[model samples]
Target: MNPLHVDLGVTGSVLDVVRAPAGVLSTPSPPVDPTAPEVVQLAADLVATMRVSPGCVGLAAPQVGVAAQVFCVDVSAHPKTRTSHGTFVLCNAEVVEASRNERAREGCMSVPDLTGDVKRATRLVVRGRVPLTGAEVTVTTDAFEARALQHEIDHCAGLLFLDRVAGAHALHQRQTYL
Candidate 1:
């Protein structure tokens, strides 16, 4: 164990992603105990699912049918990423600070069919506990990493990109998958 990070045992098997129209996807998720065995398993599942989901850079516990405040994100491979941190899983994440707003097209694994224009902070400082170690860590990041973090954090709060779209006109059906 890294002392500051819990060994959540990352797996590669894909888990079925829960879609919209499911009540859980829209309901607020409760915080999980950082050290709980179930939470540890969830952290693993989240990473696995995100790895297998196409065009996915992030995922939330609620997206997987678990109403818990946990999310996994990896923007390192994304071409748009400017400050990559590889992959990170955070439990009960809080956006302690945010600045510099920018508008961009956003999509979610849970809302796979629809994409929308959303305004998000270009820089962010997030605080959360490492589930396995119960270690509190703060991340300061910008660009694509920051956007991914905000999107996943929104999932923890039961909000989706759809809710953040500028207008109904801002929403669009995704035309490309690549």
Candidate 2:
């Protein structure tokens, strides 16, 4: 099912992307609260959001103003993400290990209208639990797909591409990202 339709928030043009601030759960405990129905629904909504948005390879809850550590990604179908097996569900994901000596251009749903060359691992091994079944899944990604996954993971932590920019002119426009 497409989860993009659940109205997580704005499509977030270049202007609105950085305007968003990350949310805090206040409790010392894990904010994910995996058992909450809203958390479940947010995961569902993210899947739909990823499905409907053109060129969106991944999305994080914080990108939509939600503090939960939930995100959705579909790289198999994307023309640029040939290394992906298919769509994936990630919850409380973390980059376990990443290969060095790799760099690639990246984009984001939150930071639309521009792309930038970011230094990232050509390959990565990510560890996380599936939001739906709560099963652990380890995904190994390389090249563009790796960048895409890393990009979304960063969002879960409230970091934007601008934070990675090396220079003011690093941003470049993309006619189409889908």
Candidate 3:
């Protein structure tokens, strides 16, 4: 475990909802260059933050103010998923293939306590390099895993779950953490 500090700067501020550029909603930016140190560090930071978050399974770089194509997800390491497969740290991940067959509720740290329902791919195949060794790997996520990956990827592009909510009125009120 490469130790890291999960630093979420100035929590509780409202996050901006990034809209898809005129022609880029359907096509996302390419993954980060795995050889880059910035990408590696962002992955580390993401892991650090997720480890400390309650029920958090994944995170993206842009959510941390780095617009690079890096993110970290570790569903297995979470004690909540003791019977699950395990944890992983991905850098420069790209969603190669996905099936748009479901819609589910989603939320984000950037967006604070507001939660909303959004449509998403039920399954996804993400290809990227392992942050620890820079080796190439492809991970196929389903169910919650798929949703988590999608949520993080959206962050990389400056998009947030609240932007995709079908019913704006259903959006939850942001509550105080303490």
Candidate 4:
């Protein structure tokens, strides 16, 4: 079964996105019960927020001021995307496998002014639970979808692209938003 094709079965309201330097963004989020009512709602909320935000492919619970290991991702429409899993939410996600590190520019809604060159795995396998069903699933992907998954996972771990940059020289001022 395609784990990415999830039906949250609940309406979600868009929540305010928290900015960088906010304690929640820096503080590690705790693993959540995937099937719990609140976790399911939070998963839906993350998806809703990501959809409403232009150029956003993923969103984590911490970005919405929730300190929980939950996130949603969708990269189907991105020009850089090679393999997409569509939209999906996961709880307690972790990278089970990764390889082929490549440096690429990354931006965050939490830190709107800067983009950083961070090395991330181009191929990845992530393991996590589906939010509504608590079904454990493994996602194997490459290219932009892999990068998007890693970015959201980092947010769950209290790290930003800034934390992954090689140095200040690798950072660039954002002139425009995609």
Candidate 5:
């Protein structure tokens, strides 16, 4: 199901993406209270911003300058997407299980202009609570969706794709990344 449909009726401006030097990107995000009205609004804002950005499947709150465990992901129209769960938002996400490591090219909104090869789990099960309802959610999948989840989870942990690159040779600078 597409969780992006959650509209809090509060208008939220698209937040600017924070870059490398910004402490927001490097600092570990604090867990958001599931029942807080503000966090619910933030989740809606995340979905709104992600929808307007081209070629972006996922966005972490840190990428948008918020140091909290909030993120939105949607693999809907991407050609590489397999087993996509559509758009969804999760607060206070935790990776419960991960297996099957695979190296693949990755890009980030926070670290633009560079796409690096990072090894990530091909299969993952991530658990989190919805911001407004406090309901627990479990996402289990593989392929591009799995990669997207891992990427956002990394952001919550204050790690960038560069941190996972296997030495300087594995990194690449490019104009675009998917």
Candidate 6:
């Protein structure tokens, strides 16, 4: 069964996304109880925020000024998506396995004006707990879904695509928001 399909059974408020240089964005988040009410609400809020943001495939707690290891992802609508699990939230997510390095362009809601070329694993296996039930799940995916997972995981670790870039040469100014 796809663990990403769990429902929080609550309406989520769309929270404002914080920009880069914010202390929360750079500071690593600590793990929280996946079954905690606050964590469940945070997970819902993340999904709500990501849904409202155009071109956003994922959103992490730090992006909304929360320093917790929680995030939501949905790459089903993306053209580049190859193996998606639909929409889901994960707490304390960690990459258990990763292979196939591939460099690709990445954008962030927190860094609205810039996009970076960052190398990420195209194949990955992640272990995390579902938000409401605290059920541990292992997601094995490839292509864009893999990239999205890694991106949000990085946010939980207080790192951005900018940090993964090789240099200034790998950065580009956004001409339009996608």
Quantify all predictions' global Cα lDDT against the true fold: 0.86, 0.66, 0.63, 0.93, 0.85, 0.94
Better-scoring candidate (lDDT), 3 or 6? 6
Candidate 4 wrongly placed segments (more than 4 Å): none
- Which 10-residue span in candidate 1 carries the lowest summed lDDT? 1-10
What TM-score against the true fold does each predicted structure earn? 0.93, 0.77, 0.71, 0.97, 0.92, 0.97
Candidate 4: count of backbone clashes, pairs at least 3 residues apart or interchain: 0
Which tens-of-lDDT digit does each residue in 1-178 have in candidate 3?
3222222232322233233332333334466666565555656566667777776677666665556677767666544332222455666667899996677566666666588878888778887676545778877767777777778777666567866787777587756667
Per-residue alpha-carbon lDDT of model 6 for 1-178, expressed as tens digits?
A: 5656888988999999999999999999999999999999999889998999988999999999999999999999999988889999999999999999999999999999999999999999999999989999999999999999999999999999999999999999987736
Of candidate 3, the 10-residue stretch with the lowest lDDT total is 2-11
- Order of the predicted models by lDDT, top scorer first: 6, 4, 1, 5, 2, 3
Give lDDT for model 1: 0.86
Residue lDDT tens for model 1, 67-175: 9999888898898989976777899999999999999999887887789999999999999988788789888899999999999999889898998998999999988
* Root-mean-square deviation per candidate: 1.9, 6.3, 6.7, 1.2, 2.3, 1.2
| Predicted candidate 5 versus true structure: per-residue lDDT over 1-178, tens digit per residue | 4443454566766877788978888889999897798888888888888989888999999888888899999998999987888888888898899999999999887777788999999999999987777888888889899999988988988989999999989878877436
Off by over 4 Å in 1: 1-6, 10-13
Candidate 6 — what's its lDDT? 0.94
What local lDDT score does residue 173 receive in model 4, on the 0 to 100 scale?
94
- Worst 10-residue stretch by lDDT in candidate 5? 1-10
The segments of candidate 6 whose C-alpha lies over 4 angstroms from its true place after superposition are: none
Question: Which pairs of residues collide in model 5?
Answer: none
lDDT of 2: 0.66
